[model samples]
Target chain A: MDAAIRFHGVGKSFKKKRVLDNISFSIPKGEVYGILGENGAGKSTMLKMMANLCLPDQGGIEVLGQKPSWELYQKIAYLSDRAKWYSDYTVEEALQYGKNFYPDFQMDRAEELVEFFKLDRRLLGKEMSKGQEARLQFLLCFSRDVELMLLDEPFSGIDLITREKMIELIIESIMERKLTLVITTHEIDEVEGLLNRVSFVKDTKIVVEGEVEELRLKSGSLKELYREVYA
Target chain B: METRVVGSYRFILDFSQPIYEQLVQQFRQMLAKGEIELGSKLPSVRDFAVQMKINPSTVVRAYQELERDGLCEKRRGQGTFITSSADQVAGLRREMAENALESFVEVLKILGVTQEEAQKMIAGVEWK
Candidate 1:
């Protein structure tokens, strides 16, 4: 029952707009946690704090049994819409770059993954279609053996088929590495099955959170509850 | 590797009943029907979750239930496999059949028909 992440009243505000307010939840190791909400639900902001990309205005947050810091960032593979480190890198080059950037990055596995996904080696990260790019991004992220993997809106722009591919690959990687994943998305239907647990963020805080089955049994499906809360 | 389907089948969500219960019941039926052969490898929790489009944790619970029932066993680092013991499979099959028969008898009682009448009705069913 080791905790991969723990947030104690974590709060953040951006330019007078409070994005998060006392958000508290703990994610256990080797679990697929879904951070779910609608648009402007502070999901991204909370993820930024975990990635050490943003400083929380108040409260404490712990990732991988330690405070958020640059060293901790090294152990976290964050997938976000943040600036691409090397969008111009070809599929092959991305692996080379990822290897140099993350010591745990597995170039051999990355090559295998790209081939498995049938992603062309010649296509640059910036040149691939949105779906192709998403698949590449997921492959590159999973190449690193990190304690925690954070995904922000993983299927936002991808097509249905590509999203399915991404989900399959993600599961394969999680099972192989026993990685802890925290994925944020507004699309409830897409992630209902992949998540081990779920936290429904509303009005700048977590209004509901629990293991998916328990919550579904106690209340109802996440989609129905999410609709009721957001409606 | 990447696109591998460790579990093959779509799981349609049933909101009225607990998902893990549904999953366990489905796997049990598959076991009784020999849809999944004895000693076969069951899919990993995450892979089954993706296939069913349900939470991975729920799949874990279902696998745990299967283990509790002596239906499946998880090998360290190898994965979960169906029970190898013949007695265990036979017991499960008998349990499933009895449960089905119980429900059938209950429906017959509600229909105001006896087992004798049910037998005649079964015999009367066209075999074409």
Candidate 2:
């Protein structure tokens, strides 16, 4: 299987505090992989490294078989909880921004997603609720025809319906496109059935990693495995 | 645990087990019992995955296994359909019954039931 993303002996530090230590994993092409951990467990750091938002202090990382760079950004859609919108930018303006920036961004698909998510076209980013903001963020990310999508904590602070819609969109995208998706999330149950593989990051290390169904057969549900490891 | 209705088949899944295996097992049981009508069109892999909130590959695997077992067949452009052969359905029914009896006998043996006692117990059941 071709690897869409690979990390070899990767390490990261923040002000001399070890954040990730010798972490290594590879996501195969078209696989839905999950990065799971409690807050500050270096889950986001790993995703950011994949997206080239941050650099690893040591070792190397590969995205789509090549090193992450501005050129490779065209094939990757990276979405985090970080605010990408201007405070005053309306939903319509944000769609325009996506169109202007991402060459692969499909305006028609964005319009359809906007309708599916029931987002108000005139709603300003600052005026949107958490769930609404998440929907908008997902719309922007999902509309792009990128081969790899790195979503960091996509379900955080969203309502149940919003999460369901987001998941539906994720599932639809996977079925429609041959996409390799890497999502960092604490919402395990929501994404459990969707993930082909998962890794549990604890104290700057990958304590557990395997195919979801294989691990479940040995250790029960992914939720139970997490509890057993983190408890 | 999650319950989903795909086509005429009602799926109550055990998440601890591999989803594709559970789906294939359910389809087998349903086919044996004639619950899933012969020649009925099964849900497309994508539609079933979306409906069940599971990965499409899981559905594809299950469908493939069913096809391999002769419980279903996928026609190129048209979609998968349940086996229309009564002989195949009967064979599955007999296979399932044998499996059930094998496990039941094993349980009786574990309980220290002799062959004669097990036979007596089997005879004591009221046939419906």
Candidate 3:
């Protein structure tokens, strides 16, 4: 089993507060992995480290068998809750920005996704709603044919209909590209359908981790298992 | 009567069983009830997987199980189709009825109802 990303004794601290403490896990290649935990569980910090946006305070992390660096960031796509874009940039301009920044970005795919998502190109980044922003962020991420995708709370700002479409599109893209996706979401039941494996993070460590089915068999459902672990 | 999916027409998987087994069972029930017509094309592995938001490999395994059960057959390169066999259909019906009756009788035994009482109840109840 080849690993897409491996974390070895990884620890991160923001000043006095330790966000992650000696956490270690490996995401297998071509798998949809879910990193699940309550808010303030260091899920966002961990994803940041994986994407080379931040460095771990202790221990090592590797992506594609090599240490994480800005160079490797091209192979990894990160979609965060507070994604940055020029306030005045239109949807088409944002696509241009993505293509200019990431050589792996496919303009055709970005256009297709924009059309599929029904994002109004005339709307400015600052003018669109949270749901529309989520769509644009996803469009930018999926435009790049990368190995690893780190998604943080993708379902929060979107409506139910858009969220369903996002889930369906995520599955379609994953199957088509054989991507390695690591998602952090508190909505366990919503994402349960697409997850192959899940890890429950607590107290700055992975409290439990296993295939979704095994976890379910052990504790009824993912939500129940989450309650049992976090209870 | 023992449906595997947690929802209607659309499928939603549960954790108690592997996805392929659930899919196989669901397809078997569908065949027995004539919900899926014999000799009709089944959804492709990718299409079904996408619809269910599950792994395509699981869908493939489900189709394999269907073929093994003689409920469906795959025409290479084209797609899988419900097997056009009258004997197989009749066998499926019998098996489904036996399974339902077996569970029904087990419940009756647990409830301490005698066979004669159950027969009388069945006869007294009007079929609508």
TM for chain B in all models? 0.80, 0.93, 0.82
CA displacement after TM-score superposition, residue B51 of candidate 2 (Å): 1.5
Interface RMSD of 3: 2.0
Candidate 2 lDDT over B52-119, as tens digits, reads 88888888999999999998999999999999999999999999999999999999989999999989
Residue A185's C-alpha lDDT in candidate 3?
A: 90
TM-score: which is higher, 1 or 2?
2
Q: What stretches of model 1 exceed 4 Å from their correct place?
A: B1-17, B33-61, B72-128
lDDT of 3 by residue, B16-112 (tens): 5566777788778777887766698888776777667676666777889889888889998999888998789889989999999999999999999
* lDDT tens digits, residue span B2-110, model 1: 1223455434456535778977887888777777778988877765766765556677788999999999999999999999887887899998889988999899999
The 10 consecutive residues of candidate 3 chain B with the worst lDDT sum are B1-10
Ranking by DockQ: 2, 3, 1
Q: Please give, for residues A26-48, the per-residue lDDT of candidate 2 as tens digits.
A: 99999999999999999999998
Interface RMSD of each: 2.6, 1.0, 2.0
lDDT of 2: 0.90
Which CAPRI quality tier does the interface of model 3 achieve? Answer: acceptable
Docking class of 1: acceptable
TM-score of chain A of each: 0.96, 0.98, 0.97
